[model samples]
Target: MRLLLLAVIAALPAAAHADEAAERGEWLARQVCSNCHTISARAPAGRNPRSPPFSAIAARPDVTAGTIATYVRQPHANMPDHGLTARQAQDLAAFILAQKPR
Candidate 1:
């Protein structure tokens, strides 16, 4: 019982941290990515038609936090380099992944 209690206690902070990260990511996306990509679920299209919506990215089978973190760190075609920190990237990934349909 003690071991189980300890395990549950240890996991509480991780869940809280993930929630926090996702919140921060949402803010960052609205401030930055919103200029091009559709950051909100309610939005049908982005300011730039070529940029994929956050929902679309979240729906991809191959998308993961690690993959998004890596992709955002590098420069890509038509996408500007935001020079996001590792933590910010992870938060952004968390926010994006959170949009995945249940």
Candidate 2:
């Protein structure tokens, strides 16, 4: 029981950190990616036609979270450079992956 309690306590901070990352990622996406891409179901009715929506990007079979993070670090020509830090890139990647369509 003591060990179990310790494990649960240890997990709490990690879970909170994960939630923080998700929130930060969402905020970053709204502030930046929302400019040129649809970030959510009810996002502003605007954005570059050429840019894939986050949901679409998330749904792509070939696109994984790691790849998305890498793209954030080194985007292709059509996508502008956001100059995001590594943490921000990971956060954005998390935000994008969270947008998978049903």
Candidate 3:
């Protein structure tokens, strides 16, 4: 029981940080990605039908935060380069991953 308690305490800070990152990512998505992608589950499809919703992306089995970050940093034919900093991309990835179906 003591070992378990110690482990849980050690993990709390990391879990809290992840939660914070997810929150920041959600805000950034609403401000920027909302124009093209549906950033939240309840949001209507974006004007660009070709752009996928964050939920769909999260649902994919192979999707990972690193992959999402890489995609966000690259220039795409349809997506305008937002020049998001590395930390922003990380936060966005965290937010998107949080949308994965439980």
In terms of lDDT, which candidate is strongest? 3
lDDT of 2 by residue, 37-90 (tens): 888887874369988889899999998878988888886788778898989988
Indicate whether candidate 1 or candidate 3 has the larger TM-score.
3
Query: Clashing residue pairs in candidate 2, if any?
Result: none
List, residue by residue over 2-71, the lDDT tens digit for candidate 3. Answer: 9999999999999999999999999999889998898887776677889988989999999999999999
- Top candidate (TM-score): 3
lDDT of each: 0.89, 0.84, 0.93
Worst 10 residues of 1 by lDDT: 38-47
Instruction: Estimate candidate 2's alpha-carbon lDDT, on a 0 to 1 scale.
Output: 0.84
Question: Which stretches in model 1 have alpha-carbon errors above 4 Å?
Answer: 1-10, 42-45
What TM-score, over all chains together, does every model reach? 0.84, 0.79, 0.94
Better by lDDT, candidate 3 or 1: 3
TM-score of model 1 (CA atoms): 0.84
Task: Return whichever of 2 and 3 wins on TM-score.
Answer: 3
Ranking by TM-score: 3, 1, 2
